[model samples]
Target: MSIAISTALQSSFADAVTRTREALAGQGFGVLTEIDMKATLKAKLDQDMENYLILGACNPPLAHRAVDIDRQIGLLLPCNVVVRTDPDDDTRVLVEAMNPQLLVQVTGDPALQEVADEVTAKLRAAIQALGPTSG
Candidate 1:
């Protein structure tokens, strides 16, 4: 399975980030944390990079269900969604979300299958809501 559910949009990086947040919220996810990778790296390592933001999104009900099935699941809690400018094309931006199904694969737990499938569906819907994917 693909590691991330993603889409490439022909949009400004700022616009892409706004739309991504709206999409995730529409799917019942809230951003618990936001990390501006570009800023952080520049300040810490004096390294420059394309505009990049990492959103730690969570759907509480689904997260609770998964955690109930396995306590250690918190390690993977709060799905990561990345909105960044495409390195090769300044006008193109990429939005990507972690594939929840990986949790079932990594944990090798059949019990998580239902929750994983549900989360995967919600995540896919959110990504699709952004707009037509160029790639």
Candidate 2:
């Protein structure tokens, strides 16, 4: 299975990020953390890269369910969603959500499968709500 659910956005990178945040919030997900990869790389390695941001998103209810199924699941809590400017075309942005099904596999628990499916659906909806690509 694909590791991520991704979509191309017609909007600018900033707008895509905002839209992603809003979409995720609509699905009961809150961004718990954000990492600006470009800035971090530039600061630490003196290497410039395309605009890229990673949003650590979590849906409390689903997270609680997963943890209830397996306490160790906290290691996978807060799914990651990445928004970045396409390297070949700065006008376009790409957004991808970490696939939650991996959690079921990692936990080796069939009980968590339902939780993973639900989370995956929510994440896919958020990405779809971003609309179509620029070109």
The top-ranked prediction according to TM-score is 1
Q: Which pairs of residues clash in candidate 1, taking residues 3 or more apart in a chain or in different chains?
A: none
lDDT of residue 133 for candidate 1: 46
User: For model 1, what is the error of residue 71's alpha carbon versus the real structure, in angstroms, after optimal superposition?
Assistant: 0.4
Q: Residue by residue across 1-135, what tens digits does model 1's lDDT show?
A: 888999999888999999999999999999999999999999999999999999999999999999999999999988999999999999999999999999999999999999999998998999999876422
lDDT values for all models: 0.93, 0.90
lDDT of 2: 0.90
1-135 per-residue lDDT for model 2 (tens digits) = 788888997788888999999999999999999999999999999999999999999999999998998999998878999999999988889998999998987778999999999999999888888875221
What TM-score, computed on C-alpha atoms, does each candidate reach? 0.97, 0.94
Query: In each prediction, how many residue pairs overlap at the backbone (N, C-alpha, C within less than 3 A)?
Result: 0, 0
